[model samples]
Target chain A: MSIIIKSSDDILPSEITDQKVFEGRREFIKKIGFGSAALLTGGHISLSHAKTAAGKYSDLPKSAFSAADKLTDFSDVSGYNNFYEFGTSKYDPAQKAKSFNSDPWSVAIEGEVEKPGVFNLEDFIKPYALEERIYRFRCVEGWSMVIPWVGFPLADMIKQFKPTSKAKYVEFVTLYDTKRMPGQVLKVLPWPYTEGLRIDEAMNPLTLMAVGLYGNDLPNQNGAPIRLVVPWKYGFKSIKSIVKIRFTEHQPLSTWNKIGPKEYGFYSNVNPQVDHPRWSQKTERKIGEPFWAPKHDTQIFNGYAEQVAHLYAGMDLKKNF
Target chain B: MDTVINSNKYSSSLYNPALIKPAVFILCLLPLMNLVWNGFNQGLGVNPAETIIRTLGDWALYILLFTLAVTPLRKIAGLTALIRVRRMLGLIMFFYASLHLLAYVWFDQYFDWNEIVKDIIKRPFITLGFATFILLIPLVLTSTNKMMKRLKRRWKTLHQMIYPISLMAVVHYFWMTRADFRQPVIIAIILSGLLAYRLFVYFKKQQSI
Candidate 1:
């Protein structure tokens, strides 16, 4: 079962154009009506306007991996969503979240961390360099998407804050505003949604603190300001509009797991062998795929088991699930 | 009293079962036609399979409810001819329900018998919906005039299962939805209203007798 592993470092210098040139190359390719950059980098061409602007965020680092598949259409990524704070329907968030106020936001990082204080969104993101990583996002509800996210690794951010030795897990909390988020008035789920990850999982290189998608600031519906993006776990684990990050000694009760423990587990890794209580999780229908598109088989740890399997060395996934 | 009865008869006569029955039959096909048109035209949205499955399920439930309302409508409106369309409505309900089941089997389960069986046993919502579909089988089979004449009183008893089947449909819907029970809640309210009307009519008839 040993496979030749090729990290992005193994890529040839010619394969990766300078970030500025890459940005310009995208537009040049799009203007010519050919996916030339995709041909060179084996990167997916996002069908949505490609890039509305060629300006690259200087702070973010160049991505390590470019997916072989096409980036999900931007409309599908932004429009079809499950940010229940806006509403329960898939279309609800886009319509309702637009009015949500994310400006002048601050996030408080506390608990077992050495530096514990409220930092405004701008200052918090200023220090870390952002990277455009294309990752597979799998939802517990049997759907998936490949998104090119603009962010830095969660570990890189956590290291600067210096988590104490006692820190075993990290907890994330979302904003709790019912006035703007009409859906919060109804108790579809416990308000002010929360999610958590093991400290080791949090420190994983694949975990991203996303600030933007497709080289633009996140749309209101897509967890504006900042959100966690854990590629291996279920999409819910990647909490949105995060206001607080607390390093904890014990596992935090995630909102979904709190409401339906039997249905949603804390460690919701994408494993085809382990099915959800109500539905089979063996396959997922990619968003915006054709009606006749055959569902692709669910991959273990969403095809990141090579990097993340060691984190859960001896625990039974079925039991944890 | 004579004038009121005459007016009722005049209005009822306007319905003209021969014309109304065929018109209603065509009207009942509109949802299916729209669904098929949308399916062909790429109007079924991003998830066409899900849309088809859900739309068929919704129409089946609506048709079943409509079929259940026929007796109550006839009694309340004093339109005896309304009873003529009841059989047609029942067959239509069966048609949509069968399609719903087929869509789920073909698209969702991919004709995976083992998976389908597992779904029925493991998922309470599917179990209830499956039972509801099963109950329609006898009702649809004996919907013919000859079978109705052969069974006589027992046929009515057999068809009465529609009440419980309708209840199961609502409950199945309620359970399947993740949240926002508004749709199922509305369905529940409609079924309750229909049931209440039947009860009121039954009691009034009993008193009159």
Candidate 2:
């Protein structure tokens, strides 16, 4: 049996262009073929050149994990940040990170892995194809943004390191140069910021080792070169400017958690039901929305519960939070 | 007595209230005007609501400090005419505080009474801030020349609440700040100095008596 798909009526021969015009057009195209070819090819070359010129990963494919929500403005995404290595204020990072050097960076992968080695950032990222994952980034301060982060799954990166059976958790550490990261000079939450994830959480497909955002190299303030992006957790859990990763048998100490154990818990998952000690987490103001706009009702696990809720199966989020 | 009289005469000649009042008034309104202009022009940065709320609170705290500073500044600097703008500055401080509360209520909470009530009850910082604002209401109401004359001796006692109110405001700020207590520390130091000056003057008066 032949399938009969509904189709539009075909164009009649009577509507076709005259032979004289068609032939003349062909002759004209041939006359300008060299210039046109150069123009066409040059345009193609420039377009591709623009992509690489912006960043190595600027032309990445979108992942299925990306959120459908309207992306936050690139200015807002890069401008307003909480990279305490630069400064404590949201705007301070953007201002103070201008002179921050992230070039020739290396990340040491150590601890319970069979292959623990320090690899240059390029070699570390060379194996996987970067993807654009537009995630809803919720801060513990009751604000949020939908960012288009470009990176591959952390699970894929973890597999190459070959974590042993003893690896129950993964720890990530930020660059601790006191001269480069001026904020480290102050005794703010202990220097060399550290964050951790359970092995399963680290291996979750949702976890991203991001290198860029908004089709450009990640701004220095937004964690240049490489950083972790754990969608289900608060922004602080997504450690920035990572210089070290270690697989451990126990939950590693985190900066905020160490500073305020009663306030910032190690499992800093975004749960609206569990309020921060100083502020409510039930609602969050979207970064770029108007001042009069009503705050969005924060979702459990930042609306990634379908993918990650099972991770916290029987655990009480309030107590863990 | 002669020195006080001489200082007053010197201050009155150099610092005319007519020019000083309008100048101080405009200076106080500048922050508000800048905020309004930025609101219209999209100059309040990524988080406009936060900037507006914070700007209002900061100005309120600053003006509160300035209001507190007026007494000590007049006495120490021998600029007795500076007291003419104290009432105006206090009123302006109250105005900013009200706006700060309104911004939090309207923008942050969206006028959700249930959430606001929970915040006031559950959050220590909010409770302190709300209490401070409440304490300011009677002070603002009794600020008028008419109320001052009516209340007479009781008015001085009532307005003394400003000392405690200012301390509570700083504490409220301290509680809300997550880390980097530099700003709060600086504010507290200035506040302590102002309070210390008053205490010193009070004890000196008692000793003389």
Candidate 3:
């Protein structure tokens, strides 16, 4: 049930000592005759407070991209999602995604990889060290969220498999099943949502293969079991509930780009200068913020410019966007 | 003819604006009230601005179409007093539409006129919606009895813009939506039916003449 790999290598013994020392000292005192139920209750209450004060995932290293803003309430994070497979409305996915079964899920790694074939979801990530990364998620629709995701660098995962030189692009495919995903009844998007990234982009240190968020197992609405979290690109580039990953020399057919080539480009990087055909991407309203809260200026490469801008050095972001 | 006579008699006693006007006023205010209540209670989901925008937009479209149906319904039900409420309904519809625009301007754009203008020009949906709002201004201004009397025949012709305005609103809704377009599709069908009904009545009147 624990999707996060809480290995000794990833979580240092110091972290465990840090968590237990105070509580352990209290327990030791309680065993000595002076302890009473009321005192024990008071100590227990303080211990819970200490846990939160320490940080949600105290063991994991804080991500460089962590936003200064407070973490959006978990309710909003789970209740607001754009999983088209469930439904169109933001609320629809939270309500309707319950039907999807992500358990016993496996990802098929094929095309130009040295180790190519089906791999169980758990086994696939067992090798790499898992960590919590707080990333700014910018949707193409001019809205955003700062999500605390638990995963490892995508480059680490791909490196283990050793992609062949032919692997110029990394393609991700979402699970497709009409019975579970009723929104498929409408031709809003091509079935089995697809997304792609340049191999360098995929290998970027910021790229994450997220399996948990808010220090818990990923909600179905939030791409349960496993999903991609590409901090620099627009959210659609971070496809959810991935079932297939293929490496190719040629660029893969991204679903949004295929659906509306002009509006949604294959790159889909966050750029304030390049406006979407329907709306301006210059600013984004952070979800869960008050109506009066000033909209934040959208950054080029979603504020990861220093980390990712090098990949697209000479390329025109205006055209690629 | 007999049904009309009977309904006409019934309407006189049943359709009292003294009672209906206040009731309709409260009914019209329900969507706004619900939104405010949700805002206070944190019931408006994660993206409350979006929920508010979409909810207000739906009410605006609903009231617009409902206002347009008044004439046909008045004739069919023989409720002559229904005409008395039509102006109010039309104005309320406009009120909701204005709020919808305000939601986008203040919450979405944050009073950024340059960006908004750019969006209005660059985006077809915003353009159509903006055009529809612009066309509605004259009709709303002229809804008063004094303007109606002053313009006379011209008033009737000018108000006919509602037919196109309604269609534009529907198109605006259709374009705004990305996928699962059932709501816009249904609204479009109803609008077409309303327009077709007007056409059928127009041709019938011409034949009789």
Candidate 4:
């Protein structure tokens, strides 16, 4: 039920070891272990003191982006989830996602790739350097979460796939079925959620195909079994439960955009300027705090403009938004 | 309520309908537990406490609507077993709704009556929500078995207040989430249909004579 690949050529074993060894950051890592990743299921996610003490950020040494938002006002990472496939209730995925058989899950890299085939999750992603990117995820519902995600950037992965010149857009699709994903039964949303990225955006160093969050494999509520991680856009744009990754010249029709054309758009960037039909997007309240707690102002491009902003050069975000 | 509270009048016997009482009590505790867990884990994630309070408040209204439907369900299905469960469920509906109100009063306003009064007066959603919750007070006060016996012929007339309360709950839900009216609309339609069934049954009974 496992597929092993020997392509750790670009990434060194030292890097992996470094990520595992966070001795210098023991105190911070210890605090994070007990903090954002706290799930309510009586502790199904066990955090050994090892990962924290090993040499935490020494693993993700330098990147264009800043560290994970550690301000007290930053939202809780674990609970900001779009687990509709597991259930409509926010926490249902955390409870019911156990039934999902992800070890056997395989990711398909197709459509405009030179190496277009179905490779097992191990062979597809194991070779890449798993860097921890601290990302600010903004949901369309006007909530936000700052997650420390561990995965290779989407560009890095796409380069490995060797996408052809015809590939102008990248698309992601979740596993769609009634059995494992019981929430599909209720059809709270249109099934098999699909999202897309412009070619340059997908290839940006910041955009990621994350496997884990808070230094652990993603809990079901936060899109286990593989999902995209786009820090700048609203969380929905980073589609969850992905079973397919396709590269095409044509723009993909996003599920939410198709459902409600105005509310969700192709480039659903986190812009305080553009408000949702129902609620203001100016500010978001951090989780695990008081009801009347003051919200931190949401940053445009989720504060990644310095590194990733050029990708959207001359493109009117307001019109496209 | 204590004046009508029956002390050891009813026994744990075959005629008492044992399973129904426990189920109602269990259902009552579920929303409270849901609120507590959501609070502790910060499950709402965005404005955790506000979202938790709001979500629990919404659940209270829905449970209240569910409680109101029991009598109409009994009339429609022609089931006598459904009748015994109604009072217990009704009290729970009120209990959660009261907690929801208390959350708003204490946590949301810091027990500031001025703000609470202003919101109730100004916001249509809060107006209906608060009014519907207030309507539950009399119903809960009279929920005891002894009170049921004492009220006798008057019980049915008094309990009719649930119709307006359920209507206001639906309206409040609709007003809160303005975009997707589908959920609240479905609930409102069901509540209307359930009441219609009772009206139809009442007219049909007279027609049979």
Candidate 5:
């Protein structure tokens, strides 16, 4: 269940955008004085205004992997979140995480990695150029959204960390602070949410280490500073506000799986056939659609099966899920 | 019994069913009216279907609890006129419950009977909710004055099903909740209090006999 290495000729020309050219175009837009105005004109007027108010991540090149589907409204994406770190309700994160401080964040990289050290978020993300990858995000709760996530591939970051041969899996942990994240005061879930992926899955080109969304630095509710974005897996597998990364030899315990092993599986891939214990995953309500709109039939691996199916080939998805 | 009857007559005269019944009916209708206003105003949030279904279900449970509370409140507070509005409240609870089920069927399942049947059979929470809705049918049918007069003693025994129906609704809610049990737990506690009051009255009656 591994991908075959392809020669340079096998790659599509559209997939090979020159980073310098992209950055040059962005610089030209900024020089022309339309950069901020262009961002301010779209459906996300409030979001763009907020970004300008904060003045963060103004120049990001769009990625080749960006989805062609219509993007979910920025307000819906930001407002309706399942960040248990803030609270259990969907609206709680946006309301409660307004004052959360994500500044001076550092991620401690340890276990089976050659260059194991605590790297400041700025230093960690400085090496790679950020791009906007609009991805289809499917939640285990049977709702889906297409999000424009800004980050580089997790594979690029992994190569720099230099994980040893003993590293069979990569585990990520979210920041744990009772004062900043009031929801942590309750033991709703074990504090400091955790998620993991197989070494191959972590190195998948589709796996992103997101730092921003909608051309702005990540909002506090959407896991400010840094987060993982595994497009094929359920949204929870993409742990947010990560403060720790550990390359381990065994499969790590994820927060949701730990809470309800039978319901939330370790490999939470999007499969219509494998329904959640309490609800059917066969269909998903696209956020921001009219109430009368029919549900979209959920696709296998959220329509990323062509890219990720090889990783789980010959394995029982129903059992794993 | 004579004093209780005398108090009922006195309270009935004071409250005036003509005015109080209409007020209670309008009060019960306000939640539905608010939902309609929100629907027209784009106020149901991101997922309107989910919001409509959940809000309708919440109101149904609330009205169900309110209907159950009428007896205890009337007995304890000597507001016997409250009993006159109980039937209307019960019917309103049925209305919300029907809307909730319809939203799930039409918006969620898209009238796919196969999927709906499968959901009722496979999912325990759905089964409990569907069963609770079904149990309400007999009670609603026998609610009219003519049917009540004809059935008389049998009607009293049949209406007791509300107790179990309310309990099942709460259990359905508890099962569907993902993590936070605060909402369901609070409903369960209030339901327990209502049932406890009935039990206390039953034991007192038996002791007197």
Candidate 6:
């Protein structure tokens, strides 16, 4: 079928923001055409933090993800999940996220910020440079998914905030509403699950704000709206359905750490050597592998040691973990 | 629900004895049919052996509970004629229970006698489930009319062992479910209440006698 496509460049931000044209595009009742012109309309293949200024990182040689020989394929991504709000089951997130909607999402940038305001995702993601970085995602349940995340590193985004000395920790909060996120209705977990990282950890170049995954928009089950992507840490630290990003002086109590302090720690860094009390963390079953195939050994820093390991040089991981 | 279970169509009349028995048999097969369908689909992507063992084991305990309920239901429902089918249903419970136990040993643990022995020794849940299976052997062997006649005086006394077996089965299920005990807890409560009712009846009967 011959398809007529509207050029995204000629369309002004004001015209694009106009309700009917954008709403029609958003609803997408008709199929979208991804032709050469569509590609020409500023759809990039590499990294940014929703920056107005593009091509900053393009000057720096792309070395991290360029090492990938192939796009990671899974037999299934179904088994890997991190829905702690639904009682920490591997299947909980997908099963309980029926109420979560990404349609009307506004992230609140608050706490020690001059521009403490809600940012709508529609306009928010439009101007940003989208980059693909294939990173290994390790779940606490001993399973892993190789995800090609499309967003700028967390350092780039946090720099935009211009934090004062008070910004010791970066606290992330999930949007909590029973109507939108039914998992909230499940009183089994404490409400508005939160996770935080030290300001230095958040400023590390490896940390990312995941906008798209697997070369496409993240599915609702995988935390669609805007979520942090901490590669070296356990998968749970990469909080999902995130609405608020706060710069706080005191360390905030994280949901998992509060529920089971012994099992989950505030640092929660990926250390295969340190076993979880209930199960061995030495190795993890790579999804799509045959049942009898041996589990591969997990890495101390999820194999990003060179990039992030130096940040925690003097501290003891065993105690912090 | 009845139509989904059994398609044997006929009018229910007081004189129709033959139609009722086969219809009941078909009704019983619905769960077995679900088991067969799920088994064919590689056990519905669940651990097949675990699924089969748990389902059959739970059902076996349920039917055993139902078999014990026969005397009570007959007393309550006041249907003396229902007595005849209780033995057959009780034996079938033993049959399914045996399969459930066999699946765990054969498929799940792969008949590793050392592991099996260790499991029985270590896990209280496994020990109870295993003990429940062992107790059923004598019941099944003595289910025949000939065995009943041969051990007439002792048969009534020997069959009372099912009470302990039922208790063990409920304990096995209850102990195994660590959290979200929606199904297992319900079964435990029902079995406990039923056994309590039996105790009440036994004491009342003794008092009257």
Instruction: Tell me how far the alpha carbon of residue A147 in candidate 2 is from the true structure, in angstroms, after superposition.
Output: 0.9
Q: On residues B1-209, what C-alpha lDDT tens digit does candidate 6 reach at each position?
A: 45333333323544233444565456555666898897666443323444576678877877877788878777887644457567877877877888887777775555558757866876677887888888888988998999999999899999988888888888787776533456776887877777888899899999999
Error of model 4, residue B100, in angstroms: 4.8
Q: Residue B175: error of model 5 in Å?
A: 0.7
List the global CA lDDT of all models: 0.81, 0.85, 0.80, 0.68, 0.85, 0.67
Question: What local lDDT score does residue A221 receive in model 1, on the 0 to 100 scale?
Answer: 90
Q: Give the residue spans of candidate 6 off by over 4 A.
A: A1-75, A78-100, A112-116, A122-128, A270-277, A280-285, A289-321, B1-75, B78-209
What docking class should model 1 receive?
A: acceptable
Q: Which stretches of candidate 2 lie over 4 Å from their true place?
A: A1-55, B1-14
Off by over 4 Å in 1: A1-62, B1-19, B196-209
**Model 5 regions more than 4 Å off:** A1-39, A42-58, B1-18
What is the DockQ for all candidates, taken in turn? 0.45, 0.69, 0.63, 0.18, 0.68, 0.08
**Per-residue alpha-carbon lDDT of candidate 4 for residues A1-321, written as tens digits (9 for 90 to 100):** 121112335233332333324334445555555433332222322333223213333344423353434422212455445678876656566667777777788888779879888988888887788766656667776566555676788888888889899999998988897888887887667778889999899988778888876556776667775789888899888888788999998999998888888778899987776666545566665444457554566666766665566666676766788
Expressed as tens digits, the lDDT of each residue in A119-191 for candidate 1 is: 9999999998777776788998888887878888899989989999999999999999889678899888888
Instruction: State candidate 5's TM-score.
Output: 0.89
Docking class of 2: medium
Worst 10 residues of 2 chain A by lDDT: A1-10
| lDDT (C-alpha) at residue A320 in model 6 | 74
TM-score (chain A only) for the predictions, listed in order: 0.86, 0.83, 0.82, 0.80, 0.86, 0.76
- Tens digit per residue, CA lDDT, model 2, A179-295: 998888888668889999999999899999999887678899999979999988999999999999999998899999998998999999998878887789999999877779799
TM-score of the A chain in candidate 6: the value is: 0.76
Estimate the TM-score for candidate 4. Answer: 0.66
Task: Report, for all candidates in order, the number of backbone clashes.
Answer: 2, 0, 0, 8, 0, 3
Predicted candidate 3 versus true structure: per-residue lDDT over B53-150, tens digit per residue: 89999999999888878887888776655676788899999999999999999888888898899889999999999999999999999998899999
TM-score of each: 0.86, 0.87, 0.86, 0.66, 0.89, 0.62
Query: Candidate 4 docking: what grade?
Result: incorrect
